[model samples]
Target: MSTAAQDHPAAPSPGPRAALAVMAVLAELSFVGASMLAWAPLILLQAIFLGPTVAAVVGVAFVLGTWWVVQPPAPPAPVLLRREQAPALFAALDALRERLDAPPLHGVALVDELNAAARLSGGFLSLVGGRRTLLLGVPLLRLLGPQEALAVIAHELGHFSRHHGRLGHWIYIVRAKWDVYLDSDPAHDSGIDRLRRWIASAFLPRFIRLSMQRSRACEFEADALAARACDATSLVQSLARLELADALMRDGLRTRLHELQAASIRPPAAFWDLVADSLRDEPAARQAATLEAGSRRPARRNDSHPPLADRAGALGEPVAPPSWTDAPCAGESLLGPLWRGTFDGANARWAEQIAPAWRLRHLHLAALRAGPDPADTAIDPLQHTLQRLQADDEIAASEQSLAALRQHAQSQPDDAPAQYALGLALLARERPEGIEQVRVAIRLDRRFAVAGYGAILSQLELHGSEGELSEFTRRRALAAEKLESLDTGLWQHLLKEELAAPPPWARALLLEAIAEDRALDACWVLRTERSNDAGQRFTLNIFVARVCHDLMAADEVDEDLLAARYGSYLRTLFPHNELARVMLRFDTEVFHPPLLERFARLPGCEIRRPTRPINVDVVRIDSL
Candidate 1:
C-alpha cells in the first residue's frame, strides 16, 4: 500500500538484492554528478562575464538534487532477536509436526516477547530455520496455562500448515532485507536505479507502514487458521490474555513517565523550543541523563496483561468463565506412559524427596519398555533434546521443552519420571512456584533422592540454624542430610543448583563459609592440588567442585581459569571417579541472574533491616 506500490503497478517485490542493485546505480549516478560538479566552476568561467545569474540557478539546483538522493531509508524494525539462535527452536517446530493431529506450523522460534506471530521462514521448508520458531517471550511463558500454551503451539503450526510461513518469510525478507540493499552500495549507475533508490529512501517507509497494515489483516487470517487447528476458544482466550498484558504494561509505563516528569529537580523547559534544543544534542549525553533520572525514580504499580476483554471481542467469541476441566494436551507424543507413571503417589514422593534425576532415569527405562509403539515413541527428539539446552541455562529453549513436557505429562500424572523431570525444572528457578512444583514431585515419590534433597535444602533455608528454625526446620535438615549420602553427585548437584540460583550474593556467602569449614577439616584440601587418601579426596573433590559452581554462579572467577583449575584439582582429589568420568559437564560461562529483581525473591534469605527508620520530615525540620 506504499505510494510507490500503488503508483507502480509492477514495482519489483522488495528484496534485499534488488534494493542493493538500485542503491548501486544511485551511488554511481551520485559519483558522476559530483565529478561533473567539480568542473562546473571551470565551465562557468568560460561564460563568467555573461552567465552569473544562470550559474547561480544551476548551483542551487545541484544542491537540492544532492540532498534529494542521499537520504537513508528507516532502519527496519529494530531486529530484536539474534538470527543465529533460530535453528534449535526451528527443530522443535519440526518435532511438534507429527504429534499434532493437524500441524498448524512447520517450525518454531524465539522472538522479542511473549506474543506469537504467524510468519513464514520459508515454504515447504518452513520448518528448516530459526525463523520458524514459535517465538515465546520469557515473561509470557511465566504466565500461560497448558491449554493456552498448546493452542499457541498449534497456532504457529497453523501458519506453516496453511503455507503462511512461506509467504510471511518472503514478505519479511522483501521488507527487511531488500530495503537494506536499496540504500547501500558504491557502484552502478542507471536512471531507473536512481529513481528507485530515491523512492525507497524517501517514501518506502510509509509504503511499508501501509504494508504492515495489510499484514495485520494477514495476522487475522493466521489467527483463524490457528483456531481451526486447535480450539477457537483457546486461541481467543490466549489472545485476550496477551492483549491485557500489553495494556497493563503500557499503563504502568505511562505512570512511571508522569512520576519522572514531576520529580525532576531542574526547572521545566519552555515548551516547543526546549524540545527542539534537546533533540539537537548528542544521543549519548541524552541517554546518560535519562538513565540518571531513572535511578532516582520510585517503583510504580504492577500492571497486568492488556485487558483480555478487547482481544476476546476481536475473536468474536462469547465470553465464558475459565474452564480447567479436562484440558487437551500434547504429552503422549513427548514422554509416553512414563509421563503417567510419574504422577503415581510413590514416585511423586521420591521425586519430591530425592534428586529429580532418579525419576527421570526411571522414566527413560519405562520408555524403553513401552517399545516403538505410539504410546512409547516421541515425535520430536529435537524438542526433547532441548533438555541439554535448558540445562545449559537457555531460558527460552528450556521453557519450550518444559512446556511440551508439561503438556504431555498431563495425561500421565502418575509418571514419576515426568513429574520429577518437571519438578527439576521448577526447582531450577528457586521461585515460590518452583518450590511448589518440586514439592509435588516429592509428594509423588517419597524416596526420590533428588526431590528429597531439594526439600531438605529448601527447608534449611526456611528453618536451619540453632535458634531460628522451628521443629519443621530441624526435621527437614535431617532429611536433607539423609539424602546427602545417596551419592557424591547429590551434594555436587545441590551446589550446582544453588550456584545457578538467580543471585549468588547469599549463596556466595554460604559457599565462603563452607570453604572455611573445608579448610578447617583439612588444610591439605585447599593447599594440595590432589589428595592421597581416596575417601578424603573424594569428599574434598566434591566440595571443591561445588565451590567452583558457587564461584561461577557469583561470576567471581575467570571461567577459563576456573575450568583449568577444576580439571587439575579434581585429579588431585579423585584419580578416578566413575561420576567424574562422565562426559556431561557444565559449560565454562559464568551464570548470573538475568535481572537484579530476582535477588529480592531468593528463598531462605533475608535482607538486613535498618537499625532505625529515618524520618525525612524530622531531618528537614532539624536542618531548618
Candidate 2:
C-alpha cells in the first residue's frame, strides 16, 4: 500500500543463511562428539574385562557426564502479550502486518528500553518459520504519539517482511553458545572446552562484525518501509524524539530515585506516571539542543543500527504535514481501559524484584545512622580523629590524627568502630596496618559494608604503588571481583546516599569503588557534584573520565557512544578545565591529531607512547 512495499527488493544474497547453516552443522557435530565421549568410556569398560561392579560404575559416570554436557540450556522466558489479553492491540498489529505484506507475528511483548525489535526463537527453524516475536519498549510507547508509535512498529515489521530476522536469530544463538563456553570455570575446562573457546574467539568476532554490517543495512531498509507505511515526517520526528526521550527517562529516573531515597520512602504505585510526567515537563528547546549536540560525535563503528540523525537525514523531506488527531494517551491506546492498572501491576512487579536490594541499602543506612556502641569507650574519640584526618590532609595534622586514633583503638580492643576508624587513619598515613585493622573490624562486625570498601581502597593503594604490572593487574581483578560479589543495586543506593550527604573522605572512597566497578550511570549521578573548589571539580572530572574509559575498555561499549552520551555534556559543564579536555580523549583513537593538539596546548601536558602497550586490566589509581 506504500512506495516501500512496491519497491522492496527480494532478500539479499544467501551468504548469511549459508553461514548459519554451517554453524548449525558445527553445533550438531559438537553434540555428536559429546555423545561419543560419553559412550567411549562405557564401550572400553565392556572390552577391558573389568568386573561387573566396575563396569556399572563407569556406565553411571558416563551417563551422568553425557547428560550434564548435552543438556540444552533453558531458554530465557520472555514477557509475552497474548492475543486474548489485548485483542485490540493484536488486531492493530494484524492490520500493520497486512499493510507490510509480512507474515503474522507469533507473539508480542513489552520491554523496558526506548526501542523496539523483532526476534525469532526455536533454533534452526528460526531461519524460516520460527516464532516471530515483536518486542516494544514501554518507554518508547509512552514517548510517542499514536502515529509515531505506528511508524516505529512498522519499522520493526519491515525487518520481518524483508526476512532479516533469521540471520540475527542464528547469530544470537551462536554468540550465546560462545558466551557459555567462555564463562566456564577454568578449573572445569578440559581440552575440549579450550578448543571451543579457541573456535569461538577465532570466528565469533568476524561473524559478529559481518552481522552488524548487515544489521545496519537492514535498519536502512526498515526505515524506508516505515517511511512508506507512515508519513516520512512522523518517522523522522520519532527517530529524533526517541533519542531525547531515552535520555530524559534515564536522567529523570535517576533524579527521582535520589529524591525517593532522601525522603526514605519507597517508590509510589504511580512511579511510571511520575517518570512520564517528568519527561513531559522537559523543555522542548532543551531536548532539541541535546539532540543537536549529540549529532556532533562520530558514529559508533560497531553499533548495529545507523545513528538517529543519519536515519532522519535519509528520510528526506516530509511528503505531507502530520495529520494530527485526538487520541488517547499512548498507554491507554496500547492497553485499552486497563492501561493504568496494567502500568501499576508492572511497577509492583519491578518493585518486588528489587525489594531485596533496597532492603539491604535501608539496613546499611540504619546501621550507619546508629550511634556509637556504649561498650566501645574509644569509638567517639576515634571518630573525631577520623574527621580530623578527613577534613585536612596536611602531613603533620594527619600524623597527629593517626596517633590519636591508634591510641583510642588500643584502649578499646573490642570496639569494631574504633578499629575501623584506626584503619582509615592508617590508610591516610600510608601504613599497611590500615588494611589489617580494617580486616579486623570486618571480622569484629560482619555487617560493616563500609569496612569492605575501606579494605578494597587499602589494597588498591598498596598494589597500585608497587609498579609491578602483573601484581597490580592481579590485585585489581581480585578487588573488582570482591566488589562485584556485593549486590550492585545495594552499592548504588549506598553510593547515591553518601554522595547526597557526603562525609568528607567517605564520598571519595565510594566514588573510587563505583569507578572500579565501571558503574557508568552512578558515575554520571556523582559527577554532578558542583564544588566551588576548582581542584575538587577537576578531580571529579578525571574520575568520571577514567570510569568512562574503563567501561569502554573492559565492557566493549562503543567509545563514540560514550562520548556523544556523556563526554559532550561534561565538556559543556567544564569548558575550560584541562582534565575535561584530557577526559574527552577517551572517545578518540590513541595519537589522534586533535588530541595531540590539545596536549600540546596544555602547559605541562605531554603524550608519550608507552614502551610496551599498556594492558587495560591494570587499575589506574588517580589521586583524589
Candidate 3:
C-alpha cells in the first residue's frame, strides 16, 4: 500500500481562511472591550473627586479585571515523547514529513483516546511557524496495521502541509483571547463591562457556530490529502477499523471492571495494558459487524467529522488492496520492542493519576463482598422476588416485591439473604427503616456485602440531608474513619499467629474493606482540596481532570477527550451527574467568568452522567 506522491497537493479553497479572519476580528473587538472595562473606571475617577469607599471598590475591580485578562490559560498536558524517547516513531514521522513537504514536528504526545490530532502551540508567531505537536492515541495506533498507520499519519500531517494547521492556530488563539475578554470579572456595573457581556453573549456563539462549520470542511480536505499521499484503501480500512476498535476497547474494559468487582480483586496498576492485550484476541469479523450495524444511524448534527462510512466512500477505489501479511502491526513496526515499554509507562502514569479512585472502587467492592450473600437463599420464591426487585422499577413495581420479601423475611427470621432483600426493598421505597433492616441482616451474617452497601448508601443519604458544608464535612470524615476502623480490625484478626486460614470469602472481604476505606478517604480529601486563593481558584479544573482520569480508568467512554471537546460540554449535557454537579457548583460559586471560559477550551474528560435525576427512585439498589 505504498504511494508515489512526493509533493504536497494544491491548497484547498480560501473559504476557511476568510471565516478565520472574521473570527479574528471578533476576537480583537472582544479584547478591546476588555481593555475598556479594565481601565475605563480608573481613568474616569482620576478626573473627578470620589469618596474613599467608591475609589477602593473601583480600584479592586480594575485590578481583578486586569489580572483576569493577563493570565494565559494553558492546555491540558498530554504524555509527551521527545524525539529521543522513541527514535523509530520519530524516524517514521520524519520520513512522512519529507514526503508531504511538511515542516518538522516539535514533539509527539499520547492521549488516552481512540483518535489522533495535530495542534499548533504559541500565539501569532505560531500561525507563521509554530511548534507542531502530534497527539496520537495508543489504542488507535494498535488497531491499524503498518500501511493503515501510515495513511492516518499522512492524513494528520496533511493539515500542516496544506496550511490548515496554520489557519487553525490563528483561529484557536483568537477564540482563547475572546474567551478571556468575555469572561473577565463584571463586578463593577460600568457601561464598558455591560458592553463586553453584550458582545460576548450576542456575537461569540455565532462565531463558534461558523468556526465549527469551517472545521468540518477542513476535515474532508484533510481526508482528500491522505487519499493522495497514501493508498486510498488503507485510509478507508483504517477508518472502518478505528470505529470497530473503539467500541471493542470500551466494551472490553467495562466487562473486565465488572468481573474484577465481582471477584473482589484489586485492579492492577497495568489495567490499560491488560485492556489493550484483551482486544488483540477479539475476532476481527465481530468488530466489523458491530461497525456495520452502528453505521445505520445518522451522524449527529454537531459531529465534528463526517461519518466513517462517508469518509471511506469519498476516498473512492484503492489503487490496490492492503497486503495484511506484508507488514507488522503499526505500533509494533513503528516502535519495535519499545511499543510495550511506552504503553507500559503510560499505563503506570495513568494508574498513579487514578490511584485514589481505584482504591475507592476496590474498597467499595470489598465492603460489598463482606455483606450478606443473596446466593445463600434456599427458598426459590424468595430468590425470584429478589430478581424482580433488581429488574423492576423501584417506585412502580417494588411494592409487590417488597411485600413478598417482607413475608419471606418474617417466615425465615434467621435468614440473612431474606432480611437483606427486605432491606433493599425498604431502601428502594425510600423508607428510613431500610438502614435498620440492613444492619439487622449484617448482625445475622457479617459477610453480607449488599447489606453493608445499603448501610453506606443510608449514610450518604443522611450526609446529603445535612444543612451545612461543615456538617457534611464532619459526617464524611466520621464515615471514612468508621470504614478504616473496620479494615484495621480485619487486618489485626488476620495477624493472630494461632488463627486458622480464613475462608476465600473471608479473605476477599478483608481486602475489600481495606480498599473501601482507602477509596472513601480519598474522595473526601479530594472534595475538600479546593483552594481559596484568587490566583489558585482555577485549581478545580485540575481536580476535575483527575476525577475524569479515574472515570476513564473505570472504563467510562462517554465523556472522553474525543467525545466532549472540553469541560463545558460535559457541564452542559450532564448537570445531574455528581462530578458535573461538583464542577457546576464550583463554577457558580468560585470560578470567575474568565476562569470558567478557560475551562471551556481545555480537553474534556467525562464520567457517566446519569440519564435521570438522582433521586432515590432511580437509584439502582442492586448495582450499589
The best candidate by lDDT is 2
Q: Give model 1's TM-score versus the native structure.
A: 0.28
lDDT tens readout by residue for model 2, 164-275:
6676665555455565543334444676676666666666556555666677777888888877766666787677766665555534455455445434535455555566
Q: What is the RMSD of candidate 1?
A: 27.7
**TM-score on alpha carbons, each prediction:** 0.28, 0.53, 0.54
Model 3 global lDDT (CA atoms, 0 to 1): 0.53
Tens digit of per-residue lDDT, candidate 1, span 508-579: 222332232211111111211222222222222232221223434564444454444433333322212201
Residue 76 of model 1, lDDT score:
29
Error of 1 at 146 (Å): 1.6
Global lDDT of each model? 0.39, 0.54, 0.53
lDDT tens per residue, model 3, 1-624: 333232334465677668667677666656655665657657567536776677767766766666456436657656678677678888888888886778777778877666888877755435554577898877676667877888898889978876667766666556665553343444444765576667776877677666666666677777777777677777877876666555654344554654554454445666654655655555666665666655553443234577666666556543222223424567777777778876677667666544444454454344343454555342254444443443332323335656766777898898776687677666644466876787677677544533255344554342233233234334334433333333223222322312222223333423333242211111100111122223221111112221223334354433343123233322221111112112211111221334323333332221222222222232122210
Worst-scoring 10-residue span by lDDT in model 1: 519-528
Rate residue 597 of model 2 by lDDT. 38
User: In terms of lDDT, which candidate is stronger, 1 or 2?
Assistant: 2
- Winning candidate number (TM-score): 3
